[model samples]
Target: MATDGHGGLIQPRKVPNPVRESQSHRELHRELLFSHSRGILPRHRAELPRVLESRRLRQLREELQGPPSDLEQQLRKCHQRLEEAAAGPDPGPRPEFLLVRDSLRKMKLAEPGAWQT
Candidate 1:
């Protein structure tokens, strides 16, 4: 039995059985003791924040690159195709017409959500 901070009755702290101590148990106990004295666990003292920051930075970098260049190229090709079609004798819908439409749809889908509204 133990006295609480306000003089109330409280359960006694349990003592670990020294007889059951093994290598792993000793290591665990050491880690627990160290963590209790310090603010953070030793193994993870700097790892968590660094990993999270790196992940955030990677996402930001990818966002900075904007849309992929291939999408822009496809759009340019579509424009060129339109110009050529307008200049030449009207040839009704080529098979490549479907490809241009698909590329435009893909480009729309690949745009960032913020731009989509």
Candidate 2:
């Protein structure tokens, strides 16, 4: 650890540090900047497998990628159990299971309907 004359810590470098960032991050950043004309599309990164990131980097990029937290894991387990138990979509036959149509429903409807009409 470098320190100044008054025993204060030295200022960090203004340049990017390899130690502070993973290789994937640097490569992805460059790729995005180089492809700026594409307008920040998610499909652009689909070719680059994001699994290469380290746990710390992944944590830092939680919005993009990371292993679920304890609470999320527990919730996922509970959700799985509920799904497995066939407890969903039951009781007097609900209407559409949801009050509103979301992306999933839109995507499903976007395809041809199963009916012969």
**Clash totals, every prediction:** 0, 0
In the range 8-95, model 1's lDDT, one tens digit per residue, is: 8566898988755778888888889888788675557688787888899999987998865988789989999999988998476668
* Model 2 poorest 10 in a row by lDDT: 46-55
Best by TM-score: 2
Query: Can you write out model 2's per-residue Cα lDDT over 1-117, one digit (the tens) per residue?
Result: 656675885667699777549989878888878778668665655544545445557668886766778999999899999887796655665467464556566767777575337
| Reference-based lDDT, residue 49, model 1 | 83
Per-residue lDDT for 111 in model 2?
73
Which parts of model 1 are misplaced by more than 4 Å?
Answer: 1-45, 71-117
Top candidate on lDDT is 1
